[model samples]
Target: GLRVLDNLPAPSLPCEQDRLRDFMGRRERGELLIQKINKLQEKLLKKMQLSVSKDGFVHFGDTVMLLNPDSKSSVKNCPGACVRLTLAINLDEISIYSFKSLEAPCGVSAVESVDPVARNTFCILSVDGAPASEPIRFGQKFSLGTTGGASDRMLYLASDHKSFIRFAKKSHLQQVFLTDELSYLTCWQAAFLDPQLRLEHEGFPVP
Candidate 1:
């Protein structure tokens, strides 16, 4: 992490431009969450209080990380599981980090996308290969980042809802999801948090 911080502009940002904006913005506000990061760079990148990862993770000089809110020492272990930190657009005070399941989910109803990438429409279902029971909405007022990017769409869902998909963008079997490594973490974060849509096996490569 210090090495990358020393390298600044060249530090690999695996995420899209939007995610970086939030980090840089918060640095301006002098938020404490970011202060912890700055303190890590006080000495040479090799001073090594904390180490930065190219993949979507941060670590202290050692491997075993222990965080205790009651102790100031815990700040070193802070940012747990969160890769790139950002403020929710609507919830300005909240921070979001991408987290991926260590293991894939099991026994959950499947979700698949019916919308083809060539077209902007995205229809989805949990069934093995059945047509949706309801009509598909051609477009929506909001977007995760890209208009037709499925992952971005899913990230939007994760951040915006209390009961994400309490009423899915559609009706039918669905629910829950969760995020990524350093450079790849943002998009991967969107992919995992995207509520675990189980596209048909045949469409394994669904957009």
Candidate 2:
């Protein structure tokens, strides 16, 4: 009886082994959860970049192409035909850089048909919609810098209550003041090369 008892394994050995196994399993699960959380955080950060500002303005400052209402057809046929417009916004002021046309030779440094025009600070104004007024009339307007302060440019950004669809139709702007409609066109259905790039109020791209 004594010899049999000596040959038997310790009674606490199996319990200790089970406890060690459980600890390892918990550690692995915890590491996996942490990895998943980190990935989720990264995605959220990317989305927060373009979130609406505290002032209820959805600001945009990136290399945006001004395409026609029929932008899909034009872009598909000839991407170079799209006019590129660069915007510089400093929360307090907005500047516009525009060229007549895009010219690319041998894929080298592209040239502009006309000298790039740099506009001074633009004034934004929001107009309330009348019962019969079109949605475009109710949105914000970026007053173009004119010699006599004529306020011609009316690139309507999306309003708080309106979807961006109204801005897509050219008919909406039939009565809207547009000295150069083609220059400030922003087609809603157009495809941007890298729309993810956003600008901060400090006039720099968000990393």
Candidate 3:
């Protein structure tokens, strides 16, 4: 019916156009923020002095040390305590360096090494609650969880609780966070939160 249809009110056009414009604006902002996040990640990596390979392995010039918790206290009060982790090219081996003093010219000894086999028991998880599919880098948050246990009983680092770490239940994951420590990435959380982010200082940002 071609009967003079020109005067029909196209009421939805303005609303649809406004919605599309809003969507585009939001997309632009999101992209810009993502760029900023990338820059921040790079900056953090440089600050941590870590060399990560293309395949997501961390590279240490020398062997990695797995320090016993009891040995860490010896250097706890010493200035510039640091730790480093290195992974092998084939991803079959991992090394950790722990409790190294910045002031000392030589390596400080560690006592009572934990079983290296424990490494095989745990895996890293990303912020979105999935097994980490990508190589972990700076500015990203992660949690450590057991690989094959009942999914509900995984343990995670909970800095704020009376215990330094806590167990995760079926629907929850307590996490450890990273902080800048004299050019190293230490498992620490900030004392205060940024008001603008609206995130509570604890249990939110893993890094």
Candidate 4:
């Protein structure tokens, strides 16, 4: 004899739905956290004006000048007699600008210069027109490859006309080879490159 048996429904755990909801909530929170972190990183970078170069150089704009220790001055006053101890070093010793407050050019995309045969050094300057000026000097001569190649003919420039002419004569190159590319470069790029070279020469991190 077969007895009729009713199938019982499977038991449902009440906590399962709560667990799913909790997991979804956590996932949403995680996404929001990631977005916040990204926004914070971007804000910090913009505030610092930090940029990295292809050659692994790090750059910050004119703000570096404000941090220069040499720019600080002390004032001494003694009963109506005041003396200002201007300990600021000449800008030339630290930067590449021919004059104070002079910056690089605006609206330029790229600038590069090379001096080959001695140490094989090359410099490339990029700018978006910031009000900062510094000169980049290579400690070593850069390679220009072959004589007939386009890279072999590099345009050289000095801070002044006399230096330009002197360099031209010393290199036995035509004066036409020298140009005023500096006029087209922005101040920030020049300053960044200037300090970069100095730091590189000192064996310091470029950033």
Per-residue CA lDDT of model 2 for 37-152, tens digit only, reads 44333321221112223443223332122222335676778776644432211111111112111111101111222222222122222222212111221123322211111223
Kindly give the stretch of ten consecutive residues in candidate 2 with the minimal lDDT sum: 100-109
How do the residues 1-207 of candidate 3 rate in per-residue lDDT, one tens digit apiece? Answer: 677769877689889999999878867775445554443333222212112345544221211222334346656775554433221111111112211111111111222323332221234544444343344443445543331112223333223233335422321444232211222222322233455553443433322
Candidate 1 Cα misplacement greater than 4 A, ranges = 1-94, 99-123, 132-207
Residue 50 CA displacement from its true place in model 4, Å: 11
Model 3 whole-model lDDT (C-alpha atoms): 0.33
| lDDT winner | 3
Every model's TM-score: 0.14, 0.19, 0.26, 0.19
Worst 10 residues of 4 by lDDT: 140-149
- Each prediction's whole-model lDDT (CA): 0.26, 0.29, 0.33, 0.29
* Off by more than 4 A, model 2: 1-74, 86-121, 126-207
Ranking by TM-score: 3, 2, 4, 1
TM match of model 3 to true structure: 0.26
Distance (Å) between predicted and true CA of 122, model 1?
8.8
| lDDT score for candidate 4 against the true structure | 0.29
Error of 4 at 143 (Å): 24
Off by more than 4 A, model 4: 1-29, 33-35, 42-66, 70-207
RMSD of 4: 21.9
lDDT string for model 1 (86-161, tens) is 2111111123221111111111112232222211121232222323232222221112121112223222112213
